[model samples]
Target: MEQTNQIERKLKLMHVVAIGLAYMSPMAVFDTFGIASDISSGHVPAAYIVVFVAILFTALSYGKLVRQFPSAGSVYTYTRNVINPYLGVIVGWVTFIAYIALPMINALLADIYLSAGFPEVPGWLWVVGLIAIITFLNIFGVKIAASVNMLLVIFQALVGVIFAYLTIRSIVKGPESFIPIGDIFPSGGEVPELFGAAALLALSFIGFDAITTLSEDTINPKKTIPKAILLVAGIGGVFFFTVTYFMQSLFPDVSIFKDIEGASPEIAVIIGGNLFLSFFLSGALFSVFASGLAAQLSASRLLYAMGRDGVLPKRFFGYLHPKFNSPVANILLIGVLSTSAIFLSLEAATSLINVGAFTAFSFVNLCVIISFFKHKGPRSFGFTVSSLLFPLIGLAFVVYLWISLDIFSIIAGLIWALLGTIYLAFTTNFFKKEPPQIAFDELEA
Candidate 1:
């Protein structure tokens, strides 16, 4: 019988980190390995190292901004408060589309994998069933969703561990010695290939930033959220580099795989035969489940933040269930939206993701630089590097990745941005007024 407008703060640091890891999907290293190895000329881990640097600097920017204005809006909240309110709405709108698209990608992947395994079952059935289970858990409670993600993430780590054991054992039993140091670094004329692989690998780190959207649901968000962001990025990076380092050492080239595009399944067969391949594929399916759960949770929290700020409809988007104290309305809306996966191609859904992700990454870094100059902090070496230099480097790195995107992604992103601009114009009466600001202090209180 009790109703509340606020989302409850119940998640601790570990829970938040778990959801973030699920969102990143550590098993993804296998999915990306074949192509990245080919591009890096047999140095996937080095490419991971290249992308991790960019991710580390950006994680620092996220940490700095979350300390100043910790809210469920993530990059959207940061931009609105630190930069301009109107700009924040546009950023939020663009990122909203991005978050919404993520669940669809997971759903599509699930459908493909499941349908491949169960030939008689329809693909659309898999998509709908996957979304339904994820939405049910999310609406049950954020804590429940986080717990599920933790278990799923643990399972993924187990699979990675087993795979690594088999790979290392195989290499030891073979003729080639483990070239630990040499293979991870590129030789002359391979820098371009390494960067190219890094650009592709950058998308894998999207979930670390998504953790910021859980601020309202997190205890001591200003401290917990920032630390959780760094932990998620750092942990995921280490897991990725460790897995690929061994894989690169074992194969040393993409020519070994039958199908480079779908090499992970084959790699499992080669390493441990059919028995381990089943476990690997099951791990991949569970990963899709984990990712969809976290994605919907983040997307709903974002909508709730914007709704509370009057950037979207207040009644529906901002509403929390009286019993569960979760964002029921927004969660269901995303659940409904996820059904679009049945109609969308995986490539199309995948392309839409990078545009929104890169935009948020680039802007969050820029927001840090803007905040540094706007709010005069103590003139010290630590503050200068943390506030300005780190973000500048992060910005440059994101710009490089942004330009590396293919022409289709660029055009799709522009079209999405244009739609957001049109909606913003209508909301603000053609730029006569600024968008409403979120009451961060009151929310924390």
Candidate 2:
């Protein structure tokens, strides 16, 4: 069956709004603050400020790319245009893997969050349920997907902003316990170490790119693409920086950090948690649910594009569901892989997430610089400084984070990327692979 291409321009714009905000919603606050605590001691808030600045530079790079080439498949899409198609497929495949890992980790995290209330229910139970809900929304259609995501993002942002406002109010009210702003630069611990720790948490800054993958469904493709990304990062950077500080101020206790008793770093509960933290924890599943929903949408589009381009089997994945106008087969394929990966690495999902993100970020940061250089096509001077210089620094920081990943986490990234290379070779040969699909048809013609 032929794909309808019915995703109207408006829905595409709305998709951008939904995906951009959803990625940075309430769950992200948990993510940022949680990671910050692990690396910065009680000064978790200060760590966010560092990551905020780093990703903010990278966001500028993304903004330039989206303005020039607005299409699905994001990083791979951009890289394919300037470099070899085969190379594009490798980047695309690796990113697809990273995208898949996102949902698995999020769903697993949701399970843990839900465990606080229904101690009897296994976390994977929540994982399964989340998979079903988001998959269905994805299958239903983009209009419904966008609407649901928009509502979810709005709800998440509202609740989070409220939490932020309250945390800020709490800070102003009295001498609540917290790592003061002055404490951001360590008194004795290595500055490089503190920066390294903060870099690891830069994983939270990743959602800014989530907007890029949905380019196939965005409105005013060139205009909205750049604006949405910058907007999300701007909001996310400020939001993360502000909330981490306030959470520390609201409850200055290191009391929450003891005996997490597992692989996952229990960041939030350690920093500013009590019974009230349960409220956020309870609501957290929805945030994770939101992340899975957004990631699935992005990944499936990627999978579909791969099939359409002959890098993957077209017979199975090339066809779209008649009713859903979506790639039901590819969506299910990614969902299953993601679910299996969660259990396969249940012991290591969290660490691997940070590690995989670093790998992808390093690849992307480097890709941007490479793409910037390879572009003989017309590009503004301002674009050069923004995309090139910024990504170089971002790439350096990503490498710094890559080394800091625990031995096990580094092993996981190496193995995953290695496996992806193998899959790319076999699949490319099997499908009689050709060039990467340009996000813009005009670029090729």
Listed per candidate, the RMSD to the true structure in angstroms reads: 1.2, 3.9
Off by over 4 Å in 2: 1-14, 31-35, 168-174, 177-190, 252-278, 345-347, 375-384, 427-433, 436-439, 442-445
Over the stretch 1-445, how does candidate 2's per-residue lDDT look in tens digits? Answer: 5665333334555567677667554465554454455556556666667777777766766776776666666777666665567767777766666677777877777776678678997667777887888888888776677787787777666657667765666666666655555765666755665686576567776677877776666666777777777777777767666766777666445456453222112433333356546555645666777778888888887777677666678767655777767778877887777776446555476665675466556666776788777778878877777678888988877777776778887676668777767887776674476654644664221
* Span of 10 residues, lowest total lDDT, candidate 1: 175-184
Evaluated against the true structure, the overall lDDT of model 1 is 0.90
Clashes per model (N, Cα, C within 3 A): 0, 6
Give lDDT tens digits, candidate 1, residues 182-266.
6568887999999999999998898999999998899999889889999999998999999998888888878878898799999
Q: Which candidate is the best by lDDT?
A: 1
Best TM-score goes to which candidate? 1
Candidate 2, number of clashes = 6
Weakest 10 consecutive residues of candidate 2 by summed lDDT? 259-268
Give the alpha-carbon lDDT of every model.
Answer: 0.90, 0.67
Residue pairs with colliding backbones in model 1 are: none
